[model samples]
Each structure stands twice: as C-alpha cells, then as structure tokens.
Target: MNRPTPAADRTDRSKRTTGPGPRGRTAGAAVLGRAAALGGLVTVLGLLPWLSGKDPALALLRARSAEQEPTPEALAAIRADLGLDAGPLGLLGDWAGGVLRGDLGTSWVSGAEVLPAVLSGLGASLTLMGAALAVALALAAVLAAPVCLRGRATAGTAAAVLASLPEFLLSLVLLIVAGVWLGLAPTSGWAGPAHLVLPALALGLPGGALLGRLVADALPAVLAERWAELWRGAGVGRARIVRAALRRALPSLLPQFGMVAVGLTGGAVAVETVFAVPGIGRTALGAAKAQDLPLLQGCVLALLALGLLAGGAAAAVRRGLLGPALREAALSLPAPLPHRGSPAVLLALAGLLAAVVTWGLLRDPYAVDLTARLAGPSAAHPLGADALGRDVLARLGHGAATTVGTAAAVTGLSWLTALALGFLPGTAAGLAEVANALPPVIVGMVVAAVTGPGTAAAALAVTLVSWPPLAAHAAALAQELRASRFLQAQRALGASPFWIATRHVLPAVAGPVARHAMLRLPGVALALASLGFLGLGAQPPSPEWGLLLDESADYVERAPVAALAPVVALGLLTVLAVRLSHTAVRLRPARPAPTSVHTEGKTPLATPAQ
Candidate 1:
C-alpha cells in the first residue's frame, strides 16, 4: 500500500495557513466565552432558589413578613437556603457553576421546573404564532402574487392599506367586530382555536403587510432576470417560472421574514394580554409586575431562544433551497489580497459612512415640531401638539427617533446577546428553539416591572425578546456556510470554530444581516411606541409617540389632529422604513457569478449578455 497523507490532513494544513488572524480568534473566543458565562448566570437564576428552597416567591414572602415583624430565624433560614450565607461573590460563583451544568431552577410562583413552565407557555405562544404565520403567508401568496405578476394596483393598494394598520389597533378592532360584535369567537380567554383568530389577525396583518411587500418587490425583479427569461424561452410555463423565481427571491426574503416573525412573536405579548391568553407573554407580564424573579428570568431566556429559532429556521430554509448557489458563489469571490490600505477604497467607505450619518441626522425625527397645542392644523403646526405644550414637530421627531433608535438598538443588542447565548458548545440550539416560541412583550413588561420603565428597561426587554432571531440567523447561516467547500476545506485544515464563524461565516452573512437589521428597526420602534402608549413604557415627559397617544386618548374629540398626527406619523415611518430597506436590498449588487469560464463560449449563460 502506498503511504499517502490523508485528504483531511492536507486540507487542515491549507486552512491553518490561510485562515483569519490569531488575534481575531482569541478575541471572538473571549467574547463567546463571556456570552456562555452570562447564559449560565441567567440559567442559574432560574434554578438556584428553587433547588435551595429559597425560591423567588418564598424570598419575597420572607422579605415582606420580615418588614412587618422581626422574623429573625425565618430570615436567617431563607438567607441560608438561598446560599446568601456564602456571601455575594460565592453565591455568584456557585450559581454560575450550576447554570453551566444546565440546572435552571424553578418557577417561583408555580414551583415548576423552569423549562417545563416556559415550554408550557411557549407551546401556546407558538400555536398562536403558527396560526398567524400561516394566515400571513397565505395572504402574502394571494395578494403579492397578483401584484408582482401584473402590478394589480387595486389589490396592491389594499394590501398596502391592510399592512399600514397598526397591530394593536387592528387586534382591538377584530376583537370587537368579529369576537364581540359578531359573536364568532370569545373576546378574551385562551380557549381553543377560536381564541386565536383576533390575535392571529393582529399578528398576521402587520406581517402580511411586510411579507406582501417583500414578495411583491422581490419576485418582480427575480422574474425580470435573465434566467427567468431563458427559462420561459425553454418552454417553462408561468407556474414553473414562478416557482423558479422563488430561488432568486428567497435568499433575500427568508431572512427578512424571519426578522418579522421574531418581532411579531414579541408583539403577540401585548395581544395575548389584551385577549387574556395564558401564554408566556401574559405569564411574563404578571410575573414582572409581581417581581417574580425566577419566572421573569425564565421568560427572558425563552424569548431569546425563540427569536433565534425563528431566525435559524428561516436561514435553514434558505440554505436548503439555495445551498448550491451559495457554495458556487463562495468559490467565485476574489481571494483576499494582502491588506495594503487603498485610498480609493478608504474614500468610498468614508463617503458611504458620511452619507448614512447625514441621512439619519437630516431625518432626525425630533426636529419636526408643531407650534400649536392641540390645535387643528394651524399655519405654524401642520401636525398639532397634544396635552403637553411641546412642539408636535419636535415631539414627532423625538418620538420617531425614539421609536426607530430604541428599536434598532434593542434589536441589535439582543441579537448580539442571543448570538453569544447560542455560541455555546451545545445549549445554543435548544435555547434558541425555546426562545423562538416565547412572547417578547411579556418579557418586556416583566423586565419593566423589575428594572423600572424608561429606556433602559425597555431596551432590556427588547433585547430579551429580539436577541433570539439574531442568534437563530447567525447560527443557521453558520450551519449553511459550513456546507461550503471553502469552509469544509478550512475546517479540515484545523481552523478553529471561532475562526470559521468570524472570518468566513460573518463576511458572507453581512449583507443579509444588515438588511434584516434595518428591516426589524421599524417593528421594534412600533412595539416600543405601542408599549409606551399603553403606559407600559417610557414614563412621563419623554416625548415618545406612545406616551403622546396615551395623553391624547381623552382629547381625540377635542383635537383629532393631535392624536391622529402621531398615529399617522408612526404608521408612515414604519411603512416607509420597510419600503426603503426592501428597495435597497433588492437593489444591492448580485452575488458574484457562481460559475465562470463556461467551456462553450457561445452557450447561453443564466444571465443574458448585454
């Protein structure tokens, strides 16, 4: 037998020499390690007290009773049981260790296993989300297909208007009209499928608006492509062309749909509350208000995981459908040349950065102020002010900025956090799956109750809710890219996990991630504003849109413009943001051609020759 080096060995050698910097791997490892540590902390918070007989409920009870009288022995026992006897640092260390071992405690109120309690609530939420997603997808298929194929203006406009309606408002209307007025379903309660309709509609309507736009916008361009044209000439029928069209459109669309699904999962929290559903969102809301620490922590973990799962599923679907294309595309990109800084490249980057900052500043939502207070569109204020003597323009700008900024920041942070959570060796996938099925608003409300409302709490809440999608996306993309030969080759060469994730996986996912990040901004803002409007966020004098709505609720008759202005502004901002991002992504340069140098020079390429 001829002795030869194994293919894996050769590949390993090649990758070791070609992979990313040692410094990047070290840094990524550190970051991911911290993430794992934090997840441990969260999980420990879930399990520690219950296992030790000092659960959140008992602790609260002990504290309350102690305040009322001198319960020294009881207090000492509670402290001992909680391992407070070990001191804070020791307590932290012990908790961290247990968490690493997957000992998430128990629900304080229910005294149930954290995972089971979370899963129970998650089951209901997922059912609702599934129903909503099914409806939304069906609607998108029906409405978007016609619009894309023919620009069916009427259907398109109706779709647009349908999407333009706010989720809470829509839910309320449906609940009243269909559930109460028509007596078709219960107005509240977590009964069977009937209880799902209004909430499903609430979730689906906004999602439909987004999906319809994505399909209508993405499909037309894909259909207009040269491959689609060639397929037509090759005697492919319209139905087949449409199916083929999905391949091109999906890479762009799936990521976005995933983000929206992540967001809608969070939005369902409030809807669940309104409808008195016993899902995680409702449970979380109650837990937050009651200061039920274990329950709240569990809910946050669950939401984070859920967001990741949804994002991951979308990524998986995309990869399944387009894996071959992605693999081929990876092969086509020019290998990175040695990094000598180029002035031209630097200038282009700087100009692009400047343009972005400038656009954000000019659109500084806080600048538009209406001078009159509750006045119906006087010359000075196009959109009248509300109860406070603030400028409508100024308030609108601030609120818009608040909504957009808060949502963007929260979504980004949570996703990053979730990425960290999912980066762990084994638990990430399970955590993401659990998180995808939880409700975000419930998490938000719970956090609000604990940390106190205002931006910080809201941000934390949003993070808990939003992080999972990012995790899911990153994880799935990582999984997909792993199938690429470039990656397989690198891995065979001994490239570390961090190296693969950061250098190879990240670069490929940058565009899709950025597009999705932009897509989710409006929804986050909407959720924040809606929460604020309901007096569940931002407190008084923040100039937030939701707060303005709350203040103007009573004055809708006295000055309709003040109330309607904010509503209109919120709706317009969301729709425009969706449109702008969708357009920009659709217009991005196509991935470099996957295959090159066709042997037959005259043979028709998938893309037409100019």
Candidate 2:
C-alpha cells in the first residue's frame, strides 16, 4: 500500500472542504434557475398592461368617467402620471425596487394601497387554510385509524369517494345542506368563526380523505418492518406499537403534506369564491376581471411565496422527523392497491353519465323562455330551468363537452410536455419545482389579463401549471430506471443512450406517468370549472358547466334542480375519472419483484453445506 505525503493529505482535505462537488453544483444551479424563473415571471407580469394591447390610459379615463373620450394630451398626462411613459423595463425595475422595499404599489381600479389590501386578503386566506389544515389532520386520523387497526375496506372506499368530489361542488353541497337546510353554519362572509366552518370543511374534507388514503397505504408497510415485529414479539402493547409505527411512517408523508398544503392554497380560489370569503384567491380573480394588473400581480406573487414557504416548511419538518441519522435516506411507500368494483356499479355510473349527455344533446341548450324562468323540474325540463329559462339538462349535456373536452386537451398537452422534459439531466427538476409553486388560478389570472378571459386562456393556464407534477414523477422514475441492473447491462453491451431510453426507459416510465396524468383529469376539469365560475373561462351562453353553476347560484333556492343537475354531472365525472384511473393501474402488466439484490459485477453462489 502506498501512503499519501503530508502535503497531498492537506491538499485532499482542502479539496474536500472547499471544492464544488456534484451535489453542490446541482444545488447552486437549482437556486440560480429558481431565481431566473421568478424574475421572468415578475417581468411578464410587469409587461401585462402592454401585452393586453388596450391603452390603460384610455381605460382609466373611461373608468373615471365612462363618457370621456381619450385625447393625445390627456393620454400623455395620464401615461406620465401612471409611469407608463417609462416603458416596460422601467416599470419592471420600479416594481422590483418597490418589492424589495416592502411596497407592493396600488390598485389601479380601487385606488387602495396594494400592500395592505393584499396583506388583509392573505391573512384571511391563511386563517382559512390553517383551519382547513387542522380539519384535514383530524379527519385523516379518524379515517386512517380504522384502516390501520382493522384493515377496513369501507374506510378506504369512503376516503376515495370523498376525495373525488371537487372542492367547488362540495362547497355548494355543504352550503345547501349544512348552511341552508340544517342551519349548522353560515353560508357566506368571513365575519366570525361560524363563517369559517363550511368553507374550511369544503376545502379540508377532500384533502383529509386524500391524506387518509396515503397514510393508510403507507402505515401497513411501516408496521410490517422487522423492528415492528420485534416490538410485537417483546409483548409491547398494540397502541404503543402503533405509535412507534406512525412515527416511522410520518417522514414518508411529508412530501404529500407539502402537496396538500399547496393544493389547499389553490383550492381556496373556488372555496372562497363560493363562500364569498374575501381572501387572496377571490381578490386575484376580482383583479383579473377588473384588469387591475398591479393588484393581480401582488396577489399572485403573494400566493407564490406562500406556496414556496409551505414546501420549505414541509421539508424542514421532514428533516426534523428523520433526524441526522437518516437525513439523506430516500424512502418511498408502495402505491395504493387499486380498488376492484362490481360490474353493476361501473355500469350504473356509466349509464348515469351517458343518460345526462344524451338527454342534453337532443335539446337546444341556448334556447330561452322568460315565462318559465327558475321553473322546477317537470316533463318539459328534466332538470329544471335556470334564471334565464335555459334547459338545465341541455346545458349539462353540452357543458360536459365544453368542460371535459377542454380538460382533456389541456391534459394531453401537459402530458406531452412532461414527457419531453422528463429526461433532462439537471435543470428540469429545479424548473419543475419553480413551476409547481404557481397555482393554476394565479396563472389563469395572468393569462386572462393578456388574452382576455375565455376557454382558451383557461386551457393554457392549466396546461402551464399541470405539467410539473407529471414531469417530476417521470423524471424520478426515469432516474430510478437508469440505475437498474438491466439498464446497466444494456449499457455494458454498448447500447446507445437514445436506443436504450426509447426501448427500455420509455416503456417503463410512460404507463405510470400516463396513469398519474389520468388520475389528475378531474383536478384539471375542476380548475377549468373554477375559472369559468370566476368569469375567466367559457363566458355566458356557452353552457359551460362552471358557467351554468355560476348562473344558477343566484336562483338556487327557487330552482335547486338547476344547480343540482350540473353538480351531479360534475360529481359523476369525478367518480368516473377515479374509477378509470385505478382500473388502468390494475390492468397494467405487473413487473416481477426482484428475488435478490445484485452487486455491480458479482453473482451469488450456493454455500455448499458451509
């Protein structure tokens, strides 16, 4: 053996301490990439007024006085006053400088200081989210306990069903059932504690259900570990064993909790809108509708920061849970086992969806009858008539196509983008994380600001934000696959990277990613519907499901069936998506489990009687 010289040892130690290793370089690059992405987002937001192609000065003049017409002198003075004459770069610089100084500027429409208004809205949203998170954790414990203790199938099924209901639809149901009929909670406003109940429940229930399912799936694995068996053999109490198992399982849940937190932030838009809570989500939607660029920018930036903070907090908590010993360890749980449904149940759901579509397609969704406005369900209108006397059944039928079709298109585009970027070496991961920080509603607000609110803008916004999850999933799977023995064998045999990726990696990754995307279809549809409900997608008379819901909300007490029609349709759609996504997973070919671990260049041989 050769010994290192003293100078060499010192040089090696210095290099170990100071050199930028692969991990260090990756971290630096990720930070720079995130910074660049954030800067680019701010720049785009700053340029929105110019991108809209509408003269802000003229709009301001009209807003100040509708009868006023724009003149060159007046326009020049207004532009100078508003700092528009400084051009896009100058405006961006000023906004960036203001942000650094804790000044968020002012609302163009309301003339209110943006910082205070945004802070107030953010406070309301944070309160709602905090309450919602508590509800979620409590619900998760309740739902997971039965499954963990008794392996109850019904508990899991209940979780899945509850998780399938979109937040907006659930909010409406809770509003009607709890607020209107039972009078257990207030229907709207953020005046007191009672006002928070329904909205928090609407947001929390689904999240809790989803979290429960994940916990249920992961806890069994933790309980099956060798250490758990040892504890049980030592005559430990069942409750004590469970407590230890839960602690062991919790770190696996942190990523999901982060996602849930981010989801709650995004779901606030529809929930707050339904409940009339003056939160940042609703404020951003209102700003988009009013073309208040400054206010919208502030709201979106605040949301972005909240999303990042949530992600970071979850990471910190996970690190704390794992402790120093296992800080760098990667742990993953098995996917939830697919639920098998009876053929009769599947047929019933299919029939319900088909009947609604066929019934609506036969009638004219656009036709109006003033005399029968807000009519109850009858022979002429199977579902009832809306405030405009439009056939609710027909609109439900046509709106399914508008809503589902748009969601499908967005999903396909997003899936394609995910596949394209999934294999990138270093940058895709960081970019995906940055992109995931933006909620679809915030993106929709920006798109609507530029293109005007419509189905196209909704689709674009959803597509932009939707790809990150799938891309991240794909990248992770691809990374794992690349390190497998079979892939290494192919590499040893001199297979080209492209050939191996296409032949081996693509097949391995695509099915799982596709199923993941399919599982997200209902979310995509809900997002589109949320935008429509906010008047940012599929405008009136288009018979879009969300637009129909928005239109029926005013007359819901008188024409409950009108609202119920679309709600049922959306619920059924969500159920269908959940069923199909799971069915696809179950139907996929299963890969054989490895019998033993293999070293790089070694094979195990029998010990031959030792």
Candidate 1: tens digits of C-alpha lDDT, residues 148-204 = 466332354445445645565566556655775588888788767777878888877
With a 3 Å backbone cut-off (N, CA, C), the pairs that clash in candidate 2 are none
Off by more than 4 A, model 2? 1-33, 61-70, 147-154, 334-338, 476-520, 583-610
Q: How many backbone clashes does candidate 1 have?
A: 27
TM-score of 1: 0.59
Q: For this target, which candidate reaches the highest TM-score against the unseen true structure?
A: 2
What would the TM-score be for candidate 2 when compared with the true structure?
0.87
Which prediction has the highest lDDT against the true structure?
2
- TM-score per candidate: 0.59, 0.87
